[model samples]
Target: MTIFIQSFGYQLWNIITNGPEIPTKLVDGQRILNMNNEFTDHEYKLLQLNAKAKHFIFSNVDRIMVTYEGTNQVKDTKINRLVHDYELFTMLENENISSMYAHFNDIINALKGLGKVVTPRFR
Candidate 1:
């Protein structure tokens, strides 16, 4: 499936940028972060580690939590989660940050907090 970067509806954008609510998934069984189809097989291999992670996004940051999924295998090599924030777009404008990806990674490392920040590449 093409991982939706952001919902196109104006309502969705409203919720994403200005809305106070953090995005969440259905509260059913275990939830998995799956964006494999968003990439080619080559890119998927590089980012395969994301399969075992849980991503949460709020405000401007996304935290990627690496954890065990259901009764499946466990993961413990990386930090709890990685964050990416669109607020970096502001930095881009100010010329404070260069590559968008690099700036986002820096923000995640610096500002990661208790239970805050998912989503990997796109959006």
Candidate 2:
């Protein structure tokens, strides 16, 4: 699970940095932090945690949340819709389990409330 999350995080970072055309699934959050060199200690920690959570959810749960904008605002309609679809897809793909769905909802809500754009490679 850790490896899965790490790989996903690395791929996500690469996608964000080098454009979304990259056919990869791992996003290296550490690389992103090193590349930016502007994130505060607390922010870096949070980013790492988010990366881990994303990796876990995507790899094991078979769903990914796509936010309309970056994570830096109150829960908007689009973001909420995205989350709903993501959870619904996960439920459909998996065994209709709701644990991961609940976890992702909490994470998305937290990110929406406290997450900043940091340095998105994508525009």
The model with the greatest lDDT is 2
Report the alpha-carbon TM-score of model 2 versus the true structure. Answer: 0.22
How many collisions between residues are there in candidate 1? 9
Model 2 over residues 45-67: C-alpha lDDT tens digits?
Answer: 65666565555555655323333
lDDT for model 2: 0.48
Give the Cα RMSD of candidate 1.
Answer: 21.8
Evaluated with TM-score, which candidate comes out highest?
2
**Deviation from native of the Cα of residue 70 in model 2, angstroms:** 32
lDDT of 1: 0.39
The positional error of residue 102 in candidate 1, measured at the CA in angstroms, is 4.2
Per-residue lDDT tens digits for candidate 1, residues 20-109, read 232223446755454545456654543432321212243223211222242122221122333224342344555544576677766565
Q: List the residue pairs that clash in candidate 1.
A: 56-117, 56-118, 62-83, 62-117, 62-118, 63-117, 63-118, 64-81, 64-82
Cα lDDT of all candidates, in order? Answer: 0.39, 0.48
Clashes of each: 9, 12
TM-score of each: 0.19, 0.22
